[model samples]
Target: MSIRHITLAALATLAAAQSASAYELDYSIDLLVPAAWPTSVVLLNVNPSDWASSTRRGAIEDAADAFLLNPSWFFIEPLEDDDSSIGPNNENELTFTSNSALLCGSSACTHLWYSGTDIVEADIYIKNDTYSVGNTKSDNLAYAGSYRSLQTLILHELGHMAGLMDEDGNYSVMGQDWNVLHAGSTDVSPYLDADSGAGLRELYGTRVGFADLSVSHWGYGGSSGGFSTHERNIVEDTSGVEPWHTTIGGEPYYVLGAGEIYRFEATLENKSDTAYTVDVSIVISPDPIITGADTELVRIPGIALSPGPTEVWLPALVPEGTTGLYYIGAIIDAGGDVPEWDETNNGQYLVAAFSW
Candidate 1:
């Protein structure tokens, strides 16, 4: 099934507007109607013309690699070319053609259609006249931004071809460019963000062996003032993890001695629109344990979660003699309690080193 279909004429109009400010605008995405692919493997052909050029070709390769890294069951492979051009063909094609008239003054554009109202194919047109880096003035601050914008554009277009909609916010390349709105904000990698990865998994299924939830921002919560229970309560109330503290995966990790009680916190955000009721299972596996399959020291049942961030806090004891890298993780919606838009992003991990 196809999520969306547009003719070349309409695509040109959209491209004209989109190219105007690859720098500005909060991009929104939609899964075209009748979403989901009929087949598991989709082959694509790249235009020799686009591949002939270094700059344009690099963008194409980067975009392709992003998807290749996480296919979610649907494999998109790029095929070699011959004398034939992108046209009415059985194979999907990505082309860089010079057609200012068709582009409506935009640097590049894409058009897609299903082969039989079920299977899909697409054509990507990059306008040679307008999208040249050599022509862009380096000193023009506003215009100078177009260099990265071009790469972002290529990444964004390839996302559409792969059956994803535009997403808003600073979260993903599928979303708006965060760097433009926030000065000094690091540029978004052309790589797939959490949302994009979740969406792809939802569409095609997990990539053979990958988790549904990815976790980060871990740390231990403890009472600040003294050893007494009342003092511990006071400390817990006053102290919190700082932004600069070292984390296993951008989350906090704690080193506690034997018999110590620690309160832990972490963040979980849903990638899809669908809500799920999950068990937020927390585990402190011994040093050297890495995957979720490792034993769980504890499980917190029936935590309700949806397509956004949820902060989890629970108390646990640091066992005697526990030391080295212990894997602390929170598995949301554990055991498939509720169906999710993407099931692959359900388990997250952090490394906490324990002491006697």
Candidate 2:
């Protein structure tokens, strides 16, 4: 017998301070803990014919690859096409369907069948007719005037299969805001943020002697609320709605002046078990990608971070003679003092900006 588990859809809730990490899990009533896969690896079957566009198929594969990064023992291996249907078929499948009822009023959905705390079977469905799906913002916007990111949607559904609950109102792949356009930008990337990684570690185990630190967008008030790059200059609409803004390379950008100092709060997360002392640096770059080689604005060293999320307030200065658009971001463990499971995710760009 198969038992229906979880479903994903558009569910919204007020933003609240997370007691631990921003990630939540699917609980088992009998075990009183998170339901998870018994084995270290889970096999998934996908038909190439189901996706006519190679780019879309690649995007789906890329979403699966993101979870293999670090601090995640739960791995996925894609198999050849299988004929098993979605519900209680005893086969793990990933496919696209035109049926609106399968989507549950969302672009996609993941259904799982579990026995006690062990997830036995899972199926993922992506709506083909309701929305245009694309790999990039340009392709998406050009194709349908607006589009749904196939990669981002797949990543969120995969997170559900990994035993993670929907984290609405925060900067996470499993968040309710995991659409193509979010917070005035089309930045739904096919990458697992630190919060999602932490949740995976909680169910599985963590990588020893290594930590994954990251920074994400921080906001105040309820769902769909306003957020600011500069803390002192908080921008909010009269009805408490988030203001619309333009983006560069799918990331939201801000406007600032040279030689000005700005303060911003960032959500720093540690996706590991142990605590570590590391340095956090604020930097500026010409694009959305952030690196240690970027122009340094300030560095705060020796900050202790326990496992989970911590609110960090940082101050940055726009250098003189700086003009045009640049990314303002933070790099945790900038000096590489501490070892990490995934060094690529250590740096995160919150706002790309234009300086006058």
Candidate 3:
């Protein structure tokens, strides 16, 4: 229990205290949970923060319970791992634990819940609020508005714990801000989709079996009124497909190619007030084919192009005799990075896919 606190705190502090982010997790991810996962996730996390108060503790607990209790998508494990008020280990201040029923790669999966800390929920971290983006400056949170704001915020955070994102969430709860977490700004459901999960896998540098490759469902880009506009609609008008409606229901532009690299000649257009962010990545299916002798996967990653036609491609140069066909497509980054799931169900996110 003690190590949990020390490690996370040290990591959080390390992440927060630093003026510049020395670490950049290629940040890929995988989905241990399936899309619209029907099963419930039990809260085995330990919180050091005094949760006795109805405010913060109740807020978090209610958020966690209410979120998991929801019958909509995935459910939370009913049996919580609240074994100890204080963990056995002094260093593990906050820990994440799960039952054998929900085991993943190893004990690390459950260990995160067993750790000790103020809070521990299923969620990822961005630049530490106190660390990476040093000064705490938020325009939305502090703003004078609705009473549901705090509750919404908690739900959003819990959603991240429940595997949701607002797209780096630039402006929402699931984003770089407050982790900027949100499901989708569009008709977009605020759930992480499959493509995004695959993106996470690629980013994490962990290759999983195609059978293990389950992604969350996401929407396309577009206006609230036109969230469901299909890819065919976006590319139908022109013979070669122009940038018109590229922004789809108008949020979350697709990643045409790997970022910080070749600028894939893809474009989009939309008139929705909702904005979309653009990113690129590659996902390799397990059964990679190599014409030569190398046993490594040899193929191109899928490119997500938002607001329209799904085009799959391959690398121009193959070191030797390596070739294979893989599933490729431009998923709209509606709620998550790769549009696997739309947390808010805002169909405005135009996700189009193609398989090579």
In model 3, state the lDDT of residue 132. 14
* TM-scores of the models, in the order given: 0.46, 0.75, 0.26
Identify the leading candidate in terms of lDDT.
2
Quote the positional error of residue 139 for candidate 3 in Å. Answer: 12
Which ranking of candidates, highest TM-score first? 2, 1, 3
Off by over 4 Å in 1: 1-33, 98-107, 115-117, 129-146, 149-151, 177-188, 212-356
Tens digit of lDDT per residue, candidate 1, span 1-356?
Answer: 01111121111111010111111111222234335456777766777766677766666665676556452666566655665566666667777656775454555555666644353666666665434222222311222334444454566666666666555322345554211111111222333444555566666676644433433331112222311010001101113332122433222345555555454555454444455555555566654223467565555555554433344554444566676656555566656655544454455444345463
**Candidate 1 vs. true structure, TM-score:** 0.46
lDDT ranking, best first: 2, 1, 3
Which of the predicted structures, 1 or 2, would earn the higher lDDT when compared with the native?
2
> How well is each residue in 219-276 modelled by candidate 3, as lDDT tens digits?
1222223111111112111123332223322232333222111111212221111223
Q: Of models 2 and 3, which has the larger TM-score?
A: 2
Candidate 2 lDDT, 1-356, residue by residue in tens: 01110110011111234433367788754546789999889988775566455766676677778667647678877665655445667788888887777777667888888898889988888777433344444545422246656666777888888888777434566663333221213333445666677788888887666567766554322233221111211212223333344654434556766775565456676767777778788788776677888877777666677766566556566778889877777888888987766677667676767766
